[model samples]
Target: MPDLNIPVKILGIGRYLPERRVSNEELARLCGRSAHWIEERNGVRERRYKSFETNAFMGARAAENALADADVGLNDIDLILNASGTAQQSIPDNAVFIQRELGERAAGTAAMTLHATCLSFLAGFDLAASLLLARRYRTILLISSDIASVALNPEEAESFSLFGDGAAAVVLSLAEGESSGLHRAAFKTFSEGAELTTVRGGGTQFHPNAKMTRAEDNLFHMDGLAVLRLVRRHAQDFLEGLEPGLSAGLGAINLVIPHQASKVGLRSLERYNWPREKIVETLSFLGNCISASLPLTLYEAIKSGRLERGDRFLMVGTGAGLSMGGLILTY
Candidate 1:
């Protein structure tokens, strides 16, 4: 008998990029730096910034595309999982807002949000697999949406130019055949570097209503070098633990869809001797959309015909929790 506990299979994938494209030149003017400086550091030429899109609006748009790709409808989705690092509001979860944007047909669908900074999508995929295997849901809509551009700090040119706004969605269902499913997954968190990347306001600890809260406190911040150092120290071991040949090279993997963290982060893959051709990246155009980065990259790979059914690929990234996670899947 086929193993009934395998990871959920992806039925369809979709992405939504805002119409307003912010070029590096625009960011350079805002940061008082040259466009070349921004590109050289972040590998981003341009990134989308929402003119009128909300997190829910973008996610719903992506979800509609995914549903169409899957040949399904909003009512067909039993659960909606928003894996965004940022929410539309502080009260109800982001998934609820997505459902609302999806219209009345999705009114009674179950909704939840899973957040682990940039690894939010991976966390949702992991959880969805388990829930599907347990017969908890028939089909699930997983979304990762973030408006990183709005929260970016212009004072921090490196990080500010490395972020963008976008959303991606995937339709997942139980594997109908043994050929496609998640192979193995692993994650590790090192809180010692937790302060390396953070947004200090909006949460209870730094509530916006608090008199001491400053506008700067709500902006995004990152010590890229510090976070890279911590990830490098443990990446090799973590990869080997997830899958044997992964540590040595990408010989067994067809493609790698990684979070568009930064130019430095993508370059780090070179250390594993993984061929540049085998890695899928969207940083140059989309920039880092927080948790939306990975899934959006995956969508691009699929649309570009880089990943195909029965091909084995790896999805991995480091998030603000100072966490690293990997998922091996047969597409």
Candidate 2:
């Protein structure tokens, strides 16, 4: 028999959301469009918003809960990894602020930030698993958080209806013996489509000049048609590539967690012939939270008893940079 054991197991999971909730009708009015038009195009009903806090603060709330659920004290955590597209300030990194809020003992914890856009959390999972397997740490906290609402342009209907603010966290620990956990992880990218989805300004490519408008400086942009095509192709490719490594048959996989981009993106998976009962979506409630969406959806699935031990999960993520990744977990 294949050795279907994982060296690291999830100890706990948690999520945090902001106070403000913007419904589709409200957003449509702000954009001078009909709510039906927005819903037909993006399938977003509402999204959360944050007014006066940084991503680190939002992320820490979820991390604190995960640590509490795991029954692990701050001193017991050996590493902290933040996967966020939005950091309060670019310098010192969000991980430093998280470490500071976690206290002096936590300040000493090995911490770093991963910047893989929406797929950052999946990347963090791979890194944490590798470290645990290497005996580098006993307990690790992984946080996926972003506040895309901060970058929204009131003029952009596509963005305002989709992106949201939220955070999700998971605690992973090295397993002493055979235990259920992360089975396999893989990632791939296609930069050819990078321009199809991105923020146009603020990076090295386009430094702000006098001609640059506020819309260009602050808004998220995307070639919706292009992204739709690329995601459908890659989602299928990723799932097919991962099928062989899964110990359970396709029907046995318990949950399929995907980024909360749009209903269109989520519906594209239906063509893959995967079991319909396995998919869990939070798009209707949370909107697209970028890096935090997938994990937050998974956290909700677990909390609602939609997931359980011995169940298999397949997580797929894609974001700007035209990047894509997938991971298989046995829990």
Candidate 3:
């Protein structure tokens, strides 16, 4: 097969977080649990909260910063794609709000939202690449933001200890000459395990009825054992499939930004022999922000100099649909 030649290059990256920082101690106190119990299980010592800003607001902030980093005005962008698991509302798509914030300068730009649970950001990346390759746009802005804490059961010790709010953005443009950014990506799903991780009542399955108000049914629920089994069985298969074009040695990968679902999930990938130093973790401090986690981690890693030009990075995201995706990028 011929190599798929995609011209997408990451022009800039940006991230934003809510002002409130919720520590494990505070969360434990709120949930009537011990801090040690939360830490030992989830490795989450702290997480951010979006008490002041909504998802769209946070996403706009990140998108603006990304545009600035790319040295482009809002008018330069031809498209905007917001990827989030949590939206401000069930309808009217958050991308519309973001377009409004960008002003008349973006009047000609196309705006939309893409949701595929935790893999949403990667899905956006793929879409943007395709659009740019087809000459549909010169530059596309991709933002991943989520206010996952709002979906959690404050009363559930597990959920209370492991969720955060944050947003991150990336700008992708056609490679002008010979730059490297997104090289290859693959996405897959295991629908049979879909019931293992999901909210039981909010959607069509159960709908929002009186029975849906039950604490457990209302909150995000997961069968940890089932998730573990699935991750263990599938993560390797997913990564191995994309390993060929990665080029860099496993140890040379500056970071492996896996979805910040749980400490257990992160550690399971480690057991697959991914280098510890190369693994960028936000679960301990930010918990899982769902679709926002990998991009937020990437933004931080770049800021802290953990990711550098010529450094290869791998992203793996898995979420409620029992979906999994892998993407390899060269910075």
lDDT score, candidate 3, position 205: 60
- lDDT string, candidate 3, 75-153, tens digits: 7888889988878776688898877776777776788999998899988888888888889888889999898887777
Model 1 agreement with the true structure over 1-331: per-residue lDDT tens digits: 1223475789998889999999999889999889999999999999999999999999999999999998988888999999989987998777889999999999999999998989999989988988898899999999999999878888999998999999999999998766788878888998998789999999998898999999988999899998999999999989888887687798778999998999999999988989899999899999999999999999999999999988988999999868999888888
Q: Each prediction's TM-score against the native?
A: 0.97, 0.92, 0.92
List candidate 1 stretches off by more than 4 Å.
1-7
- The sequence of per-residue lDDT tens digits that candidate 2 reaches over residues 161-245 is 8888999999998766655677767688889888887777765556555465455665688777788888766665565566663
Per-residue lDDT, model 3, residue 66, is 91
- What is the lDDT, from 0 to 100, of the residue 263 in candidate 2? 77
Higher-TM-score candidate of 1 and 2: 1
- Return the top candidate by lDDT: 1
Where is model 3 poorest over a 10-residue stretch in terms of lDDT? 244-253
Per-residue lDDT, model 1, residue 244, is 77
Q: C-alpha displacement of 57 in model 1, angstroms?
A: 0.4
